[model samples]
Target: MTLYLHLGAHKTATTLLQNVLKHNEAALEERGLARIKIQPRHLFWHLYRDGDRDAFKKRRRTLARKLQQYYKSWPNAVLSSETMFGTSDLHRVNCLYPRADTALRVLAQLTSGMNRKVIFYVRRQDNFIESSFINRLQTLATSLHLDHAQLLSDTTWCSFEHYLSSFTPSQLSWLHLIKRMEAHFGAENLIIRPFESIHRGNAAYAESFLAPMCATHDLELAPQVYENRSFSAKALEEFIRLAPKQGFANLRSLRLHLQDKYPNTSYPRPMLLSPEQRQEILQTLATENSILFEQYFSDVDRTDISYQPVGS
Candidate 1:
């Protein structure tokens, strides 16, 4: 069996892709592909061999056995999980797919194993940072009382510097990550995509990139998938305003609690900065995220892609 794994680096249209796949599951199945649905739809740990401790490991060995059973039942499976990209626990992953390689090494390992393919889409640093901040604020508002200014000021809240504390600039840079993964996996086995190209109303970009893998597995492409959600900057500001008053201490707890309260909340709009604020935030990000930004921009220029239109 061949596995097509999409490891999201976050805030890069993962939800869009998942929605597309889920919406077109029937078409995908006709093409000899399966979405591998586990109950609770959003949860992916059910597919891994290790029981999810965060969810109480309810099924434990039974879940793992079921996953293995399904895995063996199909010749081609596409498994996706954004959380997989954030985790540093190699043991948890190894336990699931014993022969699977790390995201940084999966490309080369695919040649010997069940023909593996890794697909990753990355957003430019500036846009990614801005959007990520709003995401954090909306995420924080559920539990804590937070406003835009406070969230921006709190180093522990959301900032390029804070993220760098956990992941090195090199490790976090998509260009570097791709290079390292390609070095181990073989360039042919890895696919790198820019966020701009995929979002440019070109629904075929995803299918084009996945075509080779699909052909290898005798799978067909589904019809074009459209985005149902619209981007909103105003909504983000409102979320930020509601944050601090919510009284949650950290983002993690705040997110869970917020989901419980507003289960249907969509992506908050991008926060719009005034001219002065935009310049100030840009300068701050540039200074605080110098190493990472430089690396990230260098890759952007080399790739010759922009997530937004000129002047946007």
Candidate 2:
């Protein structure tokens, strides 16, 4: 059996894609694909964070055997997780995917001696950082309450301005991340796409992601399912203003309350970056993006890789 893993870069409609894939599980099964919905936290999370080589090796072998069983039953076994490359917290180190190499190496070891492929979608740097920062705040608010001191000291509570300034343009390069993935998985085994391809329309975006599952040209998929909608700009503004004053549960409730009151259909997404900032980011990454196109996505539209604003 061939293993298909979706290694998310985050803020790239990963949830939506997962939902769509799940919705069409029966169809995929008929087409020789099975969605393997294992909780990554139990396997990949421990492997990525733990330094004990003996324990890591033990878990890797256990997981590999589990995969082997799935392969015996199905021709295609699939796993999808956004955290496979590490969390947005890695940005605290002032780099996009600082631990990605280590994560990829772990993955390479796990799927060793098997036919494995990885799907990764990458957004433009400025949009990715801004959306990732907002998503990180939402994620953290649901987990732990921060006192005034923790709020001040915690990287998660920092303003978008500080977060954006934390990394140099080179540090956020998708090219650098892709090279690491290619090093581990081989360029031929990776399926890479621009996150902005959703701009072609949702149906097109769904098709691009589902392409790897196609055993033939006529594989059918469910209509696109939208998931994990972003909080409105007003909702996020209120969240940041009141998060420290509230408990974690209260913060989550307040966020949901605010989201209901000021949905994205009425309010815009958080436009933290100005037009100038966006252009600067696009210009800075132009060379690397060009090389990315030439090397991996020569058939994709160059215009699709251009700067698309966060909520646009």
Candidate 3:
């Protein structure tokens, strides 16, 4: 069976894509495909976090058996998860997805001998970093299941400037992540998409993400249901100030409450970086972006990937 593994650089509409696949399971099955859902924690811990080789071997074998069962039902399947790359907590100012290579290596071992194709969505480095910072803050506030010592660390909740200050703009390179992916999953097997292309409030946006993974543009997709909307700027500031004071359960509940109260659609996204900084981020990566486009996206419409700041 051919496995389409969607390794998300999060904040790239990954959750919405996952939901659409689940909603359209019947449609996919009719097309000789299926969406195989796995708990994020399983991959995060067993594959990415754990260093126990013997334990990981046993776990990998167990997961392989589970996947074989899925393949018995459907000849082609997609396994989608951002955690397949690494956890949000791994993000630091100086390093982006520091454990990405390790995680990909572990995943490569798990899916050995299978016809595996990797599906990835690349976002602009500036926007990607800002969004990831907001996501980390959200996780810190709501992830009560994590150990308090780790979860409550000051660095985890540090200001966006502090986070960005840790790494030079030149260090923010998609090439590093893409190279790691190619090393493990062959360059020919990668289906990379620019996140900006179909992200312009398109109702059928999920189709763009899904069709590539399923290897069919002729899919009959259900209506896209938006999920995991970003918190508005005002809401984010208020949430941050209040988050440190609340207990975990309360903070989690508050986050849910605020999601409905101040969805990104209703207000501007949090602007952690000034326009100057945003430009610096873009200028710093211009050559890198050009190389990325020239190498991987020669056939596609290169104009759509300006990595322009939203609402600019």
Candidate 3 lDDT over 28-109, as tens digits, reads 8888788886766654466444467777677677777877777667778888888755555434444556777766886787
TM-score of each: 0.57, 0.87, 0.86
Q: Which stretches of candidate 1 lie over 4 Å from their true place?
A: 38-72, 87-112, 141-172, 215-231, 247-312
* Candidate-wise lDDT, in order: 0.49, 0.73, 0.72
Q: What is the total number of backbone clashes in candidate 1? A: 15
lDDT string, candidate 2, 180-229, tens digits: 88899899998888888887776677777877676534544335355455
Off by more than 4 A, model 3: 46-55, 71-73, 89-94, 142-158, 200-204, 213-224, 308-312
lDDT, candidate 1, residue 236?
36
* Model 1 lDDT tens row, 1-312: 666667665666677667657766666666666665544323333324244656533443444454455457766667666554332221112121222234334223323445666776666555654555545455443322235356545656533344424332222234445656567666666666666665444355545545644442332333445443322544433444455555445644545444444433364545444455444434543432344334433363335554332343
Estimate the lDDT of model 2.
0.73
lDDT of the structure predicted as candidate 1: 0.49
Best by lDDT: 2
